[model samples]
Target: MILLLFLVSCNNGSGSEKIKAAVICTSPEAAKIGIDVLKKGGNAFDAAVAVGFAMAVAWPSAGNIGGGGFLVGRTAANEAFTIDYREKAPMLGFKDMFLDEKGEPVEDMSTYGYAASGVPGSVDGMWRFHQKYGSLPWKDLVQPAIDLAENGFEMTRDLASSLNYQAENLSKTPEAAAIFTKTGGFVIGDRLIQKNLANTLRKVAEQGRDGFYTGEVAEEIARSVEEKGGFIRLKDLEQYEAKFRDPIRFNYRGYEIISMPPPSSGGTALYAILKSFERYNPADYPYASAEYIQLFTEICRQVYADRSEFLGDPDFYEVPMQKLLSDEYISMITDQIKFADQHLTSEQVKPAKDLIAESTETTHWSIVDEKGNMVSNTTTLNGGYGAKVVAGSTGFLLNNEMDDFSIKPGVANMYGLLGNIANAIEPGKRMLSSMTPTLILKDGKPFMTVGSPGGSRIITIVAQAIIRVIDYNYSMNEAVNLARIHHQWLPDEIQFERGAMSFSVAEQLKSWGYELNRYSSYGDCHGILFKNDGNLQLGISTRSNGAAEWY
Candidate 1:
């Protein structure tokens, strides 16, 4: 790990351009896997595939083939694109799947068992990514994960603690218990192995997407879901396909920001917040000061208000992309923030007049290869360990992403953020998400790749990283490791990372009528800052366990 002090003196784009490529991710082992791929002639896309699959083995809490996510990248050729592999509700799924006979949400129905699992798309997504842009052999990229799963890797304190925390829930599923639980419980340095997961990875390496979506593995998943009274079935697995989508592109202070689009509110919400800050340079105000916090809070309030009302799966709902992102609309929202007397209460800041309703334990990794390929990917299984049920012998936990949808319009999902009809659950429809895999370009060259793992705080964490680097001129480490603050419209409170605010700033915010709440810590953001001199500066967050590798 690069010392924080060394990172402080490193000026982005101005340092000695010795480092050529870099990978920053949530786990040291995964980061090493990514760097190894780059060393072996793989491009950023290939390394992303390797790191992604490796994370599934080494960072199981949030990474898994049974889950799904989004990927945003700027190719070596300067093309920007996104892959939407977000999990979709199965054909058997219904709008009220989580509701009991009384029409009320059954407790834990959408977040704790096979009943909560959605049709996973990660394996398919990685396969598609490899097909489209990978330079390395598919099997070669996946072999590391298979090996890790088969041979086992030493457990870290964090991994041990996470498994223990979910011991009760994980033990409920026999398959999950056999793999995740130890005689007493996992401890640091213990070797964790999953032969079943290795076998699954081998099939994927051999047959690509078909290995998981069809045949034995798929059958096992479907059968387990059915036996457990869940909605997934063989048809859902057979029909699943990850898609390539045009990334949301917008200019912010001359830097072009590209991110995931609908079905993921991340890109849209990020743009709204960044665009609102365009007129006002945040560098003028001290970082984490009362003034800066208030400004950020107001913009987030307005943007999140819009998120609850107008964002969702474009395939299912007609999101007003153009209107919501228009100059007029952005100006109006910025005006509110610019001239605000106090924080806008949730009631005062409502969604635009008539919009079609259409939005965390998550994992993120940023990779930049020597050939100028940049990939920013964020994958997740909803809450930590997701649904806590492994597909019969698949040896991976299923995602509880069903909770991501607005099961009941006007109801808050697991993240405490309310959703509306636009985000209602539907058969084969992807749920709205806050996974913002994003990229930035300066002078048409890849500049930064960033994303985070925080249920609702992802957008804010990412936005703040960009702000700190571009506006405040902080180094990549400082940009990401700095304390973060988040505000989702409903709940109407400014969430400060425990030590995020000073006593003076906290007292000042309260004086301004803002309700403040302290969260231990949220995002585990990781990124690479492409220096002007052709170096790669990694911003691996210290807030959580992660590593940055460069060569």
Candidate 2:
């Protein structure tokens, strides 16, 4: 049986009726900041803005001012939209930037150091969203982040572990090393101050987008990149713009799913997977049963195969969105699943033109305000502490998002996914991404807001959560906490989270000729579900030091 997890309650000013404002973020401090914004009479958009800036301070592994991501939001009046803050390759970037004399990828060129950094869009993205939707003063939303950076916050065990894990890379850059490392190295419970970052945030609060993208901050970024042998110029920073696009909307079991569109492949892949399952009732197979797992794995494999061949930055490439999402296309693919079959060979599943394509290290937050406003955001630096390089005096890590592009066609990037021309590097192009920040609605009102950070696994994790909720009748907590499995159509293996399935189920899968891999955990999801009765429920992943706060 599923149990709904009710977070603390918040009352409207009159204290009569409960105001269902809630926030679930990757860190307690960030969540608290968001909730505080709600308490100050700000709406969900304001809370999201506050959380985005605060996460940059508290969760540096993926939450970063120097990085970029997407935001999916619904206004109190039922307006749905998306902001694409995804980072773009610098104008100097090229298809062969990562190649060597022999045309082989240069060692770590796409994943580390200055060359990996893209023109950051996080600041501009936030600014755009706030400009259109925020009710709070821009400076007010950023002040908490500035305060946290200046006075410092106690480093959590996870942050300490991440700092240590990336120590070697961090040590390579003086700016990064100075902020993360103490004489004795990073330690849990130690106060970590980012005075320089605090000053940078102050400028952003005072001057808005121009504060970060131009002037002193922009010059510092260029200097850091040039000093370390990179091509990003002040022009790249100045040209950066966060786009506002229509959110991809699809119907699943009568509920409307709103998600980020390309340059994020997440929404398309997710829609494909869910639509593939349209023919079957998940409850009939029993949750996590061998039968269900086998079917789920096959669908994942098919959807990802399509993702590699069909998805990319729409600005640069023509994505066959209508054809891919067509009922005919979904039926054609779903027909391939044979219930009695143990495995579907790659050869048996015909590839579209025989082409292939695309972090667990990212952050997500979900918020729903009292008046029915909703926001689902996923942000990243591409890798832990991103390129492990900080822009000189900026005191923030730079994103290695260039690595997200297919540096070598048909070859896997750092995330172990292959790609083709659709995602290849190009000047001024946004790299293809798998960040899926999604919102779901029932009867045209917000039902649930969900998103996670797990690189390619994000699409599957989110799809499975929705399946658990709508099909299996799991509550928000149960849906999020349920064990999960992922199959990305490559390597022909199914990776399952530890304890997600039973030993008997694994043995059964093997008997059916399937290869299985196990991991301790997968994605860290944060979610909010608005109940029919006007109450709210929240769930934060136990895998991370996240929190769910309401009121």
What's the distance in Å from true for residue 180, model 1? 0.5
lDDT of 1: 0.87
Question: In candidate 2, how many Å is residue 240 off?
Answer: 0.6
Q: lDDT tens string, model 1, 154-212?
A: 98888899899889999997899999987788889999998999999999999999999
lDDT of each: 0.87, 0.86
Global lDDT for candidate 2?
A: 0.86
- When summed lDDT is taken over every stretch of 10 residues in candidate 2, the lowest stretch is 1-10
TM-score of 1: 0.96
lDDT at residue 231 of model 1 (Cα atoms): 92
For 1-551, candidate 2 gives per-residue lDDT tens digits of: 11113332332122234547888887778888998899899999999999999999989889989999999999979899999999999999999999999999999999999999998999999999999999999999999999999999988777888788778778886888899876657778998899999999999999999999999999999988988899899999998999999999999999999999999988888888888886788767788998888888888888887777677889999888887778877776777787655457765665554322128888899999888899999999988788988899999999999999989877788877778788888999999899999999999988999999898889989999888888888777767777899988886888998877899989988888888998778688877877777877676677765677775
Best by TM-score: 1
